[model samples]
Target: MLKPYNKKPLSYAKQVHHLQSKGLSIHNVAWAEGILAKYGYYRLSAYWYPYRIRSGNNVLDRFKPGTSFEKIVQLYEFDTELRLQIFGAIEIIETFYERN
Candidate 1:
């Protein structure tokens, strides 16, 4: 089943503003806007999900204290690089099995 996306689209600047409103500490506005433009809000959102404030079983939209946008970007980069390294190892293992 499909549901409607009722939220309106925001510009890169608005996206950064939204993050700030939600308690995300962003020192580099230009870089943050550029990242939003490049990777987009949805793609980068996963990285920030963990920084959101939690209340029991429910997760709040706002971030925890001192949650920085730089940390989110760093996490995203680390995860991406880690996945690439894992895949490279997996490919080697697959090749080894194929050669046997």
Candidate 2:
């Protein structure tokens, strides 16, 4: 469901909500973009192929010096599902900020 990596981060929670609203899974929210390329088919599949999957830590390692996402995850010991929740909350707060 993801597009190629972009220069910036997309909305994790917005993607989650968009996917879930369509009865799709958010397991790959961090990586997937939920972009409908053609015929409404998401580029990626729902299957969590271990071989093609990378751990969240790898993504975290690339965090910018001042980013708080890693710290938040560490503070909460967020597991897969919990990470989604935390990311969702972060998205909400960011959305609120952007609108103001």
Candidate 3:
């Protein structure tokens, strides 16, 4: 397992740019991709992008009686909490973004 570290706060754009740079720096192999993809912090913006680009097609689209943005936010919050419970701290994973 990877050792944990203190996380520094960063804006969304900064984090994404850092990850893109890190991804490009490594060898283009499945192991590398797997290792990189395992960091959930790097995927946060990608997860939120769909909602940003198409707010109308969120989970609401699946149901005839639609849902609200607040519910989507709650779902994301719950998902993050669950992932943290299953893995370790989100801050621990987020720390890597600052390193790059």
Predicted model with the maximum lDDT: 1
Give the lowest summed-lDDT range of ten residues in model 1. 35-44
Count of steric clashes across candidates, in order: 0, 2, 0
lDDT of 2 by residue, 7-46 (tens): 5533655644554554444345543333332212222221
Instruction: Give the Cα lDDT of each candidate.
Output: 0.94, 0.42, 0.45
Reference-based lDDT, residue 99, model 3 = 92
Q: Write the per-residue lDDT of candidate 1 for residues 4-86, one digit (tens) a residue.
A: 98988998999999999999999999999998888888999988998999999999999999999999999998999999999
Query: CA lDDT of 10 in candidate 1?
Result: 91
Please give each candidate's TM-score.
0.90, 0.23, 0.27
Where does candidate 3 stray beyond 4 Å?
1-63, 89-100
Which regions of candidate 1 deviate over 4 angstroms? Answer: 1-6
Q: Which residue pairs show backbone clashes in model 3?
A: none
Tens digit of per-residue lDDT, candidate 3, span 1-100? 9888878865544543453443322233343344334544444434434443234545421212232323434456688789878676667678878898
In model 1, the number of clashes is 0
Clashing pairs in 1: none
Name the lDDT of candidate 3: 0.45
Show where candidate 2 strays beyond 4 Å. 1-78
